[model samples]
Target: MAEKLFGTDGIRGTVNKGAIRPDMFLRFGEALGYTLRKAGDRPVVVIGRDTRASGLILQSAIVSGLLNAGADVALVDVLPTPALGWLTVQNGAAAGLMITASHNPFHDNGVKVFGPAGYKLSGAQQDEIEAIIQDPGFDCTVPAERFGRVVDAEFDVSSYADFAVRTAGPDVSLSGLKVVIDAANGAGVSAAEPVFRSLGAEVIMLADVPDGVNINTKCGALHPEGLSEVVRANSANVGIAFDGDADRILVVDENGEVADGDQIMGAIAIDAKAQGRLAGDTVVATIMSNLGLEGALSREGIKLERTKVGDRYVVERLREGGFSIGGEQSGHVVLADHVTTGDAIIAAIAVLSIMVREGKKASEVLSVFEPVPQLLENVRYQSDDPLSAETVKARIESVSENLGDSGRVVVRKSGTEPLIRVMVEAYEREYAERAVNEIIAEILKADGQ
Candidate 1:
């Protein structure tokens, strides 16, 4: 059987489980290093991780494997995922790896590898590494003389922060902005606050304390309710909530109403187009993006091109067309003009610049479009081929037909988790909710839930 380690993004799972254990991570590192060594001589691989308690163990093992394979290792400690990608290009290294599970809890950790150009490794690159790891006879041992040096590079983290600051452009400043930053207590624990404060914003930090276990506990992008409450209570002008790795974000308005990627992209796209900065006069998003966003962009004569789910694919589509803006509804916005990957801090700063330029309120600027009623539900199953089941297919097709032109239904297996997702969109709120619930119920029944 083929090595089924990589998913939509990278290898991710609960620590101590199948593909996330130390042994596996070590092998992953060795395989990655072994592969890179073939492409060039004296390959350097930079490493970073999040605040998850398991990250240290995994990082150490991976680093060891890389060293054994004769690849130089540079450790930046804990930082955002985008920083890893950015530093890959900055250091002129062969590759970069970030040990994180993103929005998943601390017990979960994974590795995302980036190529020299600061983008996620292409499918062919990942396939080569996977093949190496799966080969039972591959050699990972190396003589001591070939052992690569390891550097504790604190300056790399500082450079990424500096990069974030410069991403806001030379003319923009947040001098009077009172920004509430919810760092998710993961990688953002070290990133978001400094950038905002340095930009002259009065920062009220929330969920910034990462005690290993508290990375995403009711904090960050996944659970923005706490951020909303705090934003409302503090009367802060805006709230920025980052995922564990800080590659994505969700902005909370002053009223504590959370604005997702759809709203954020809507506002940014409008502003970029008005400033004549939007490349190709287009924006890219995933199939999961809100229908309202498509309509809103249409009104402005900007095309809303979509790809499959995953910010990696969005970034791929963005680069292919030279589009300047692209992202997911989950708030993984990619300003291709700046960072190669999604940088929540950079996206927030860009939006803050827009706010300053327009002299508008956070709510007024963020609420760029009125969203149509949409409902999504997840159904967990023990089998990997649930989507292939006849009952599940029939129900999904039935729902899709019911929604017709006035509505739509999206049913797909999650790339990161072992769950099937059903999303219903319609003009009527009750209809959308009912359709999603019914399909979820049917799937649960089919799976014997």
Candidate 2:
């Protein structure tokens, strides 16, 4: 393992190479085992993975490292990422590891590590683990007598399902509603339908079958176009899609209208405020959230707190401010009263619960704002820092000035992907689109693309 192996999420990259190789995965687990030992004598590590061709090899390799390092292991094979964290907290394990690439294609994979408290490892903690993994003299195995053991974790789908059920509250019901759940052929395949069915909805499933290579292939939250057609065809009351690890969600309405995370947050925030469950009258979102969401929350007297573009950062701000709700535009909604991370299934339940409680369709209940016209485009570059170029800065400044108070321009590098994201929001679509295109052109010119 090299320095800064962990990305915005965790140690993710193309499998069999770079940070996600078998050897590196083992080292990550070994380092984690040592870290866990600092907390308890008999440290236990719980492992879960989504459906992918590389998941099996990676899981076994990680288990080997954990056992070699004198840590007991429980394997919840093919479970969602949040479920692993929940299991870690439920079993009181020292640490939790989830193998998934989330919305990435099957060729890539990752390992997300959580602490005993079920929250992600802090930045300092991640740095420490990386240091341990990189040290040439660090041992991967302990003495034979101190070696740990591994076992198959009892797959209790109900525990997580129960959490989702409870998130909707006792009075909420989906008795007569028709729902469609698109699993993206990943970890949510086993859990999504069960959770919805237990709530009394007639559920329709899409992309629920996982063939390893097909996970997240034109399905799930990242690409819900297909789900929209199904929802419209079936005339279902709502459609819900999840990423590979099931931590993020995207919603589709009966008329095939899709709502991004910002819309979801806006709707949920309004509902929480009406019910007086929105603690401190605040909502947390990442910097990538739509500007309209902030306006909508403001109209309801709910404050919108924006952190850097990550759900972990959003959750951190929520915890620091004693807030109860936070999320990202990518659909990573974290309800503090529910699970630690963004449990997409629970988020779906919460949104649907609002629909039932209001006796309205999803489009009606989730229509919390008239979003500002926005355009976001990514430009790939082979430079150390593409956005620092004089020409790029000039273009960004020019666009910001042109939009004036009615628009905004945000240009930044993606933490996980290799591109600079140019986001322009304006009162009109033409302005936003033009500004974004101009920025992309400037970036490409700078990169000599």
Candidate 3:
């Protein structure tokens, strides 16, 4: 039997390899179609992709599978994952498929599914789809008359821009501010340009041209140094860098300092509390979030809840706890009251709104809390079986104890790689680095490296 392919987020790997191969994608689509058909009749699936060269091939294979399974497909050419999610529900589709690997390198790609409500499929739902994919007797055929039809919809840059503007409200506008945006040459390129321009800000764009291979080429959130340099060179008020799919955003202040998701959440949380708009006066973040962020929110009498690393988990916690805001430290902010998922465009608007309303620089507005030093290292193992090794567990426990209250340590196997992530955060950079290094050394020793 083929190995199970789905990861914590979705099936992701180097294009044409492992779970990301064309055949696998075709099978995945067929399985998805079968699952949706079992749930109801004549299900519709909306599809979108990033500007990757391999995206077209994967999309074609997926569409073929969906069509072969007797479903209708709506092709929304080159859109962000969140937009595809919103469009899925808006068009009453049974499922939405976004073709992009998010922050992964250019050679990699991924597929993430959304339910009819524009939310990601639950763990059980993914498992069911996987089961169907692995079933030998599952029907992969479709009737000629019932084959899916694909309709090309004009990309609605205005609709998303309008939604972002409305979310910011008419009272808030960045009339005289100058802002620089690095779209990572991915899904947000076209939409972010118009949205910022419409909001009355002088917009400067970098990495906005997507030639398929250039998406996230050392330019987006994963590499904000370029954006920071641009911000400093142009003396812009602020800078926003978005990942490949534009679901997450990293902000660069006027001083060209990077303000990560935790800082942004702190700023927004404090402001929301002051305005009495923070539901339950609480915010949700991942365990990877900085300790300073928790302290900052706590000082305001707002509760902070930590979940696992994925934004899906963060969103789940937010929904279950009735919280209005939550996100990952990587800038995947979810304003659940406004959008169903992490939206870089919406988060950018929120950050810009704070600047416009306060008449402050992005640096001034975003620096709501001082972040502690954090170090993260990913150690690849020779064999995947070693993650559950006894020595690794003992090392993790020992490191956790050493961290105590002065610092934090997290060591876990990567859901998508044959590696373990070693993360340490503390008030002092040296201590965090040493803690992470020691843990990595232990993992290396166990691996006989």
For all predicted structures, in order, the TM-scores are 0.97, 0.97, 0.97
Q: Which candidate ranks first by lDDT, i.e. highest?
A: 1
lDDT of 1: 0.88
Clashing pairs in 2: none
lDDT of 1 at 97: 93
C-alpha RMSD (angstroms) for model 2: 1.6
- Model 1 shows how many backbone clashes? 0
lDDT of each: 0.88, 0.86, 0.86
Q: For model 1, where is the 10-residue window of minimal lDDT? A: 149-158
What is the C-alpha lDDT profile of model 1 across 1-449, one tens digit per residue? 65488888888888887766798888888898888888886799999999999889999999888998989999888999998898888888889999999988788889998998989988888888888888869996678898888965544877989989998888888999889999989898777778888899999999988899999898899999999998889888999999999999999999999999999998999998998999999999998888999999999999999899999999999989999999999999999998888889889998898888889989999977899888888888875576777888888898888878988888888887888888999999898988888888777877777
lDDT by residue for model 3 (1-449), tens: 77787887787888867667898788888889878888776888989888899999999999989888877788887888888888887777898899988988879997989999988988999999889888868786677887878865443445666777788887887888889999999999758988888889999999999998999989999999999999999989999999999999999999999999998888888888999999999999988998889888899999999999889898888888889999999899999988878999988898899888878888788877877888999899896466576877787788778768988888777776677888998878987888788778878888889
Candidate 2: worst-modelled 10 consecutive residues by lDDT:
151-160
| Two-way lDDT contest, 1 vs 2, winner | 1
- Write the candidate numbers in order of decreasing lDDT: 1, 2, 3
